[model samples]
Target: MPEYQIFKNIQKHISLSDSERQLFISLVVEKDIAKKEIVLEQGSISRKLYFVEFGSLRAFNVNEEGRESTIMFAVQDWWITDMNSFINQKPALLSIETLEVSRLIEFDFSTLEELYKRLPKFERFFRIIFQNAYIREQLRVLDKISFTTEQQYTRFVEKYPQIVQKVTQKQIASYLGVTPEFLSAVKKK
Candidate 1:
């Protein structure tokens, strides 16, 4: 697929001029990530913002006991990054890893800042994306706090049907705050 398709999808949500589009495209660097590769590690600065061109990635945090808790997952056309590290230039609390062989379009922090200056409209596009992500995170938190495992699994399936097919049951269980066995039970019901 053309890189322009990604820009065009984003354009549907936020208008951009021809020059701005070209500039944005120029700032992005394409990369191929191997399955299970770590994109960002905890306690390291997240210098890049990634737009998935193909395949899936997951972000998670390790607990004191070394258990991983899934925070977010990004598939094709989704963006993934540790916002705190990217925006504040601080150490990241989360880690991002590819779940499968993936292609990504990435922009470093400096490049993004330059793009922001060259095209202010890009900020609006990012703001909308961030707002939607925030809302989804808030809902996920609420669901984990208030809903049963089955309910969480159901909601997850309804919200991201593609994820059910693409991601492992264990990963999906982690995202839903359930055990893989419990997820199987929920599915059976």
Candidate 2:
């Protein structure tokens, strides 16, 4: 599918004029990354916002023991990036890497800023997106604190059936704040 279609799908809830759509398209660059390739690494400034066109990507943070804790995953039609670094222009605490060979539409912060200035309507579109993301993250956090491993696994499967098959067990375990062995046990029961 074309990058424009991905943008259009995301823009479905927003009102955009032809000129604004063109302007938004002009700001993004399409690129492909191979599986296991790092799109954004920890300690680096995250310069771009990525819209996943195909395949999957994982965002994770490493602890003192160098164990990776998955923060989020993005698959086709989803968006992925280090929000903190992208917004603050500071070094990223998270690393984003492709789990499968992927195509992405990337928008740099400067270009995004320019688009916001040139087409103020786009600000509303992005605000809605950000708000939705924030709410989802909050819900995920609440689930993590309130639910058991089995409950989380059930909820995850219910929420993202596609992801359970596409993502590896270890990645899924990390996302659920569990060890791979525990995830396997949960699955067996």
Query: Please, what is the whole-model Cα lDDT of each candidate in the order they appear?
Result: 0.86, 0.88
Work out the TM-score per prediction: 0.92, 0.94
Cα RMSD (Å) per model?
1.7, 1.6
Candidate 1 wrong stretches, greater than 4 Å: 1-3
Tens-digit lDDT string for candidate 2 (63-153): 8899999999998888889998999999999999998899998989988888789888778878888888999999999998999899999
Candidate 2 residue-wise lDDT at 143 = 98
Superposed by TM-score, candidate 2 places the C-alpha of residue 9 at a distance from the truth, in angstroms, of 2.6
The candidate maximizing lDDT is 2
- For candidate 1, give the lDDT: 0.86
Kindly report which residue pairs in candidate 2 clash with one another.
none
Q: Which residues of candidate 2, in runs, are more than 4 Å off? A: 1-3
Q: What's the distance in Å from true for residue 143, model 1?
A: 1.8
Local distance difference test, candidate 2: 0.88
